[model samples]
Target: MAIDDSLATGQRSLGDPAHDYPLWPPLTSGCPRTSTEDVSYPVEVDYAYDKADPAALFSPVRARGGLERWAPLLPPLPAPGLGEGATPLVEIEPGVYVKDESRNPTWSHKDRLNRCTTSAAVGVGAPGIAVASSGNHGASAAAYAARAGLPCVVFTGPDTPPAVDAFLNAYGAVVLPVPWEARWPLLRLVVERLGLHPVSNLTTTHTGHAYGPEGYKTVAYEIFQDVGVPSAVFVPTGYGELLFGVWKGFEELRRLGLADRVPRVFACESAASGALHRAFAEGAPAAHVTVGASEAYSIASPVSGYRGVLAVRASGGRALLVDDRQLADAQGELARAGLWTELSAAAGLAGLRSLGGQAPEDGPVVCVSTSSGFKDKGMGTHRTAPATPTWEEVERRLRAAGIAG
Candidate 1:
């Protein structure tokens, strides 16, 4: 794949812009200046915005290539993509919308991140790519690495979702189901010894791949194009990469003089581990918490990232925590609205509903549905009993289900 003449200038520390590095050898580790400290900061890709043409960059005409369409604002994408991005903005209610990210090639928003992270692997000439994920991230990494024709090793928990397990194997990825605490260590060793690029977090506080979140920025761009600047964007956040990316994308639009204001970006997390919310409560840049049992497995992250704090604080947004009951209710609501989302993915809507009637009323609100319900754990375990074919049985079943005659 040809590299775009991307306007990406360099990488900078999120904590301090004084510490800058070249775009090559993307700092998989957190910012070197702060890594040894208690809280390490993540690095972000910088673009030469002064040189970018707002007209050409924000053109309404749909482009063919995947994230490459926003190449000017993105890091150089050297790897081939699997048609990620350009997800639908579904209007489930009058002034509310759902950015259904399941429409992506891999049926999750992680497709957007992996497309760029895998490209980083190719650009750096790494032998393969590695990730530590519960489900969606690993599946996405495998698909993109396969598309790039590179080997992939996914480090997952022992109880990997059946659907995601199938996805990993279908992509021919080497799946390693290790203890949750051991996956990151194994991933670091793979990167150091095997020369595989990592697409997931390595730091104690979750400073993920520099290029990964850049891919997520496209969600904001698409939202801007579809409905202008929304009043708020609620994101189902784990490490906060997606929340940060959405905030950065809108900030970029405002910087380029394309939009007047950026929206309040909400980070919605599972109450089982509301890392971001906890961090905010303690006035910390990042924090870690003991993860409890939660059916919303994807967003029940034990650690929160500094990137998420930056996004929420900068956008004047709030981090809301939703419990399993709230998650299930939101999931049921989405299903009723004709959108099937993972229990974790419904965190966004769950957060919105937690606000009662206090949701922002200035403009439209968007709850980003991060993945499909098919990716949920124990998805294939349900067995539907066969019903009798008799008219009496059918009518009785219909009546039991509250169906009218």
Candidate 2:
């Protein structure tokens, strides 16, 4: 059950019986692969840990960086630090806090993921890293790869946000905007032919990079450190790496005797897909849902991974779905509270709101806002007035708008 690789015990597949694999090279081709199949599935990393002495981890030296504070439990890989972790937990209401992940180096939660996945590339001796994303993921991967001095390639859909395009270019990543269906095949080729480390999903059912979610575990650790375990955590879910990682982190804490119990983790997804929601409703092993239009494209994953389902079921959590209307309302609420989150990032808040009177009656609630507003696909779609008016006219306009009434 345990294969030693530093403090990391090993990895295992999500299937029944949980097939184990050695820790090195990440078992990236998938765990327990048979000659009869060629598809790769998700696997989880197992850590060997003693009861946690929180003081040992909370020292001044370790307070700054992200997951590096828990290096013993993670893969032994060199970090290309871009200040990806250690984001703020700001309380916007009486009993709810927003874990603002946009404060990361790349202005999104994907920075946490890339830091781990890119380190995996370094650990595995890969020349570069490749992923299929035009949003936060690609930009973050490019940034981390640049920091690591590795070539980066991003396969995105053609209608990528200009800000994201600029971000990828700034980090010197080669971007290929092709058909949506073509991205995975191209990414697989990048992994197979060029030996680049693939960080995103390239499988049938969305088994994401094993190390990527390790970065997300730090979110839970940081939350526990700041506010203790909340009653529940609402996370914007795509492939569910962040959801699973946060749950796993809490699991580690409980295993290490740091917390009394793990919090209920909520998977907040766009109603357009709601893959995890469908899976849970159907009691299926994995998510399979029809894709539809959604403004929160970042988390509207057509295929949901078992990791998310496992996180929800294991943590006694629920999967909540929100439409674009609810997403916009949540975004407005966050903006009013001085957190300008992307539509996708607001899914967590929307999910929390959807709870209505059914919300748990004990403990604080934490909603993870994943990225900045600028990452929204309609970033600059608003109109502005020309500045040809005099001060008097401006004041008149302000009065007319009721700003200076």
Candidate 3:
């Protein structure tokens, strides 16, 4: 397929017998139809690296900045940015690293996604952007929309954390609290009637925005640059956009003769409602599971997408599920290690623990921590009592607490 020599040419579907389409606005919903019933899976940008300069394509300039660092592989970013990428890769333990995405401008990994999706809104000349989110996605989208000087509307659930709602409102986004089932329909209306660009799932199986995950690919690029290809990468998966993006980034690196081996990717999900795990177990293309109550609401997806399956299967990885108890333990462990993350964000570490003995012998495993602990709904649930400022009382309390040797 002929493509633009500089940047991207078009998009290609991940459906059976993949098809291609031109690069343009409203391109995601218009990707080549895959099923007889008119269902469309996700589409990825196609870059003509063969025609372009490979040396300049993977130049040192990529080591700086956010999504712009890898602009050659991303869509046209007409929107302003907030320095969303370049997160730290800290070694939490021996042979294990944590990609701390909480350092992003919005204090979550969703900023990377919004950078591209909001740009699509600008590229299409849309007046505003909309998303169906209660947490990171909503906050990140609102920030990016504000950065781009565009209006934003968020279809949030009733149980959304007050802090998240506050941040969204602070960004000047229209926060609409609706029923879970009604969010998508309302988002559709916001997109169709008001001509707003949507950055969330519009399809049945989560064919997310065409340009959104392309921004996620920068995570993989950053990881590869920081410490080379890891032995494995454990990711907290909801719709699996980040999982697929990281895999695609490494895949691109290998295709470009940069890396010889791609890390074994793992889709770490909530056991209470692991749709991807269920799908993998049942040998189905995609599957739906009745979501149960869980603290990891951000990663509890009722319906999963084929993009996740593609990432795991393509990268010789597996899908693992962890319960709330495990997630809590992992959260504590991360905090002990000086990295506080949201309950859902600790799923990667929980999944990594689940593979204790069976972990790859190559070592150097990387786990992606998605968000900050402040976003946790159960945060500050514990109470602390203040003591009087007296040396006698202090010594007694310290002795009782075993701190006064």
Candidate 4:
């Protein structure tokens, strides 16, 4: 098949693609969150999705405030609406703000990761993109692949939600529902044999794509621009890419003289799988542990990332373990604040609440809410008693639920 010329490539290129998406100048510093080794590299930029010729996310106008100001015209972001970045840093409570990332293209922070990583595929001339995820990551991958006009293949656990399945199908993705155990091998086969760019964490370890985190850095950029540096950032923990990306983004800003100090980042995870926590506590680079204590199952990974550990240590950050009860409370609290987020998404808020007011009170604090309640689907759907009532009865129920009659 004569694939489209806009595919991402295997080699790291400073070269432009069929469409020249803007990019920052070459990185001059080592990993912002790690002194151990390289985080990842040769990330690509897919087609820019901004409705205008240059989106404000990557525009010098916006960058003047963030590190993007340092590399004005740094590759323009392909942020095509649906609230890609620059999410409102709302101060729902005194001294605390939510950098609600549930507003992204796929309704989660994963969109940022794919935006940068999938661009790598187009930059290197890869024909398609592949991901192994049961949730937000797969949806985000499909969205980006569709935007770039490249084929997308998703390998996810069979338990993947119906909404997620429908989304992939709607986006023209080749969805392959497989057993969780087989995801890794399948991802490798697809990328190696099919020449597809992978936006997944492979290696049955912390080995992740360099490009994915590039997109994620935009969160830190937005936070710095909107709220300045907080004492800490609490990230919903998973493969640790998001945690590291936020840390790196701030560190880069400081390096470029964009900001003053890096925040003490926190990886908020469900107590079920405390791989990252266990690793940090064990004084090991990484660790593997099985867990089953929370519905924040989206982040229940057995593997701990050496890079994740490095991030926590370098930033003087901490990892906090949360439970399902705490996550449910956080989700409820967010609803009260008019932000409906998924269990995994609310995990950050849960971690913060768990920490009480112990976090430094001087600077602005932001919690990245990663996904939406719809992504969880389980919460949005209910088998409640049928509302098959007369009009008056229905009105009574509506009023009871606080809906205006």
What lDDT would each prediction earn against the true structure?
0.90, 0.83, 0.85, 0.70
Number of the candidate with higher lDDT, 2 or 3: 3
Best by TM-score: 1
Give per-residue CA lDDT, model 4, range 111-216, as digits (tens): 7767655656776767988888888988888887888888999998877878878888888999999988899898888877988888786654575665566667
Over the full model, what C-alpha lDDT does candidate 2 score relative to the true structure? 0.83
How much does each candidate deviate from the true structure in C-alpha RMSD?
A: 1.2, 3.0, 2.7, 7.6
For candidate 4, give the lDDT of residue 7.
28
In candidate 2, position 31 carries an lDDT of 58
Off by over 4 Å in 2: 1-6, 33-41, 51-53, 58-62, 357-360
Best-matching candidate per lDDT? 1
Q: TM-scores of all models?
A: 0.98, 0.93, 0.94, 0.79
Error of 1 at 271 (Å): 0.5
lDDT of 1 at 399: 92
- In model 1, what lDDT does residue 211 have? 89
Clashing residue pairs in candidate 1 (N, C-alpha, C atoms within 3 angstroms): none
Off by over 4 Å in 3: 1-6, 30-32, 36-39, 52-63, 357-359, 380-383
